[model samples]
Target: MADVLSLKQSILIYLERSGGLERLAEDCEPYNDPQRTEAVYRFNVSVHPSDVMEVDPELGDCLLHDPLTATTLFQSACFQVIKSLSLIGKLQTESQVNVILNYTHLPPFPEYTLDLCRFPRVHRPVRPVSMEGLVIAITRVTKYTQGARFLCTNDDCPSAGGFHHIRVHTPGATESAVVRNDFSCTNCRSPLTEDVKFRVLGGEIISGQQRTSTSESHCFVFLTRTDELCNSMRIGRRYRLLGIPAHVHKWPNIACSVEANRVQPWNKVSASFQRLLRETSSSLWRFSAVVAHCFGLHVAPPGSYNTLKLSLLLSLMQTTTDAEDTFHNVDLLVVTTDTLIVDRFKGSET
Candidate 1:
């Protein structure tokens, strides 16, 4: 307890000295409106692990290994700073405020940075980890319990009337998993009933499979960040994600899922590939013909259906670079009655 308090104190000092408190205050200004009835306000704080290491090595290590506890302490420190700044009264009586620390700028931790295929063997539960893969699927936006208030059911209990036990959603926990009403009170040993009115909901995006190009291994990942951040991800795009790995219980077996803390789009084209493209820019037509001829030597004869093969290659390039908005998008509509040829082309494309 003493160490925790000291660590929290250190975090409070760091926030004050690093101008995190001032930024938090600025974030809360819009919520200060008396008529607003928001149940929760999330204040994102950008933190650089390198800076933290320079200031306090122990705290920095704690953030890397034990992120949940460290983030809780950071939240407590932010709340303390909020109260000291007299911004607490701006929120509703039942409102809960959260401080989200973004470690996006943190230098990669080599030991914890793992490949998708090695996830089953190398992953450490609840520890911060980083992985790179393509985003294959995404679910629609859903509501998750950010925080919930539970009241002791026993009327005669001393802790029943005055105090409310608040449960906040943590990484790896689901809304139903955290906000259930079967909790027993510590003071009176009474059942705690959830106060539905005080529940705070947040957006959730569940993405399926962080797949790699070289391996068949994959894992599920979900983003609990704000809606804007979650919605920014696109299918078929590769990304580097940093987060904690947790076991999700399936009926017969447990599967690993990453609770992504940060998502960054990764460039699929290698430096050598980019250089090759640049070198071939002047003789692009010749390069295209050569590439089409060599595209599928095993599935079809070389130089056969050169026009179709070149068109397919152009389609792929356009689709992959569509997000850049620099290239004109192409839509391919092949109208052919030759089923055998179509099948051969599809096999070659695959």
Candidate 2:
């Protein structure tokens, strides 16, 4: 409780010092939707560190990193800042809010396909609609041009095996060469070829639910995040991902991915669950996990990774004070997207 309070105070202080609401408004200038923007403005502004902290290392230097704070307040500053703009409809795409770079005002990305719906209430497969979930499995991958092949020109070099990441002068080599990291081969003295680099995350999501003793049959939820943040996903953590229900490829091998355009931590339990008392949604079982991490108190050696995942899911399941002790079911979400045509109708009605 104290930490969260302190975090909120730090957030308020940071925003005020950085330029407050008006400057934030300037950051939002890209979003041109007038009516939606106005209603969003009426929504209150509040900051919770867990929901806003920037954990990715690449973004660490973008804001002040107060090493003194045990949690490293520096990491989350940029995320919270960008979130402030997003809340007021100042920015359209949450893919990569450019706070680290200079404040160039590119027009807001026109909102297109974001559809919000009700996440599953029970442990059953919801029909594949455009939805969001906390990422359970994801991996970061870098794309290199297959053109980065290098073969020694030596006739008797013993081993003329091809290599990767070497710099070679191409067929149309007129300009001075880029530094070749590989040494001149002792056998052939040949250089390797080079090209640009690309990186992204590829993974599947089972609607972002952990396994339970009586878990329901899960469906394929393929999502991809193409940026530095793709690697930031933690196994037990939660994320609010946005994607459409679209099929790819053809026939028997055909697969479906969410085609994610937005990703953020899903801190507030689902919309329906939010109506419950605070104790029901959070805190009831949070102490044990916090204590385990803070004090490094392992009750027992976790037998396997699956066991650990099951334990984490178990920890999140706390019953409400009600007679039935209703479960707050925070496992998944129904995503929402606004249509431009619908927005126009809404605008005309207003």
Candidate 3:
């Protein structure tokens, strides 16, 4: 209990020093009115592990090893700060307020980032980890119970009337497992009954795979924010995923899965190539012709097939930048009876 209190105090001090308390108070202003009917008041707080480390090294280490406990401490600290500021007007219950700690920036730890091939061998369960690979598959949107309120079944129990028992969804826990009805109350030793009205629902689950140059591994990724992330992901595209690795129990076997915290689009191009392209783009007049000449040099002489090469280059450019300019769309189709030259062209590197 002392350690928990110390951690909570450290979190509170970090929030105050980082100006998170002010942000929390401002975010809670909307629900300050007693007439508000919203059942849940969510406070989204962005946390930087480096910043936390600057304040308290032990707390920062705790945040990395035991993220769930750190998050709960952050929530408790935010609730205390908000209550002290009188921002939580009539919202006095634990079920009414939720604090979401978004770890936007993580410290540069070697264990935090792992290659797809090294993930299985090096990953620590329940700790934050990052992996980069192509997205091969995605699942449809599904409903999940984020949190549920349970009441003691015994009417004579002191905790029967209040929303005393609460179960929250955790990493590696299934939806059915969180809201399971066969729970015994601590006070009266009676079975708990779930109150459906107090149940909180979250967005969706996404599954994908991770691949490296040497090896490929099947990875199951779950994302909580569906509407924001689902539209941006495409099956053949590569992405960098920051999540927690866990062993999920299936019927017959336990499968390894990742609870994704953040999804980032991965760029395959090298920095030097990008820099060269940027430098070349500065000279707009001769850029297209130069690019086309270089693009077809591997397949044929630069000056021999200038027109065809230019057309192909223009089509590729248009396809890549189609989202930026919808009006100036160009499509190219090459027609020829020579199969040998076409085969050679197909074999050339892009």
Candidate 4:
């Protein structure tokens, strides 16, 4: 009698099962649960009569079918999951619901709604600013433009839009003239002009000249280390970069307590000078070793092939020898927050 009663109850369940009675459920974490290390991403799924074929053999045999009822049942199950989690203080926001729906990889049905309170806000990372190389050249005044001349920096003005202009006063000279031209853009050669004009940009001199202008337009564009910012610019000179309102000047041989020490040779025995030279030598050796190692590593793999080669090269160069530090030539690599300009004399044997 008990077996007969169980069979009757099973028969009633078979008629109510969706499709063929295969049950499926989605397992997603609720938002702001704080129980998980990371937020849960979501997805979507679709159900149909064809999708049901497991769990109940009787339902399969009977072929129960009802699309509308099946959809309602599926929606109820999903919402129940969400509501249960919400009541448990797990469902964080409406956005999380949307995430789960979309993550199932199915188009959202009209019955679905999203929760937004569950997710944390995202922020972007910040970056540091940097400058590029420059080369300044002082060209002779054009014949057509009397009392005017061009101080051409190594940078092509047309290529880099407008060039850097600096104003300077000669000790015994009067006012001069200047002129400029726009060149091609550095990247796209679309007849480029300055996207944004830099009015007060300044730099030290690497090379320059002192000459008379034939034209009225005397222009100085400090684009390179070898540029003359003054009317009487010269080679083997240094300058201070300053910009005050509309006036910009590249003052030459402007001494500061910081860099003034490097200008003179140490004829007297000073500990500071001795230490500076020693530090400079050691730095040069390290730079050379680093460069050589980098080059060797590029040729082959480090452990089996390039390793032996790099080791051999280092031995041959005597990079480990403290005595060999004297042979190394180390130029100063000056860096600043705003620029990476290197000051090297043009045609100098040193």
Query: For every model in order, what is the number of clashing pairs?
Result: 0, 16, 0, 47
Clashes in candidate 1: how many? 0
lDDT score, candidate 3: 0.69
User: Model 3, range 68-151, lDDT digits (tens) per residue?
Assistant: 777688777776776777887766656555666667666566778655455365246567777777877777777777777788
Superior candidate under lDDT, 2 versus 4 = 2
| lDDT on C-alpha atoms for all candidate structures | 0.69, 0.36, 0.69, 0.29
What's the CA error at residue 59 for candidate 3, in Å?
A: 0.5
Alpha-carbon error at 101 in model 1, in Å? 2.5
TM-score of each model, in listed order: 0.69, 0.25, 0.69, 0.15
Error of 1 at 271 (Å): 3.1
Clashing pairs in 1: none
Output the number of the lDDT-best candidate: 1
Worst ten in a row by lDDT for model 4: 256-265
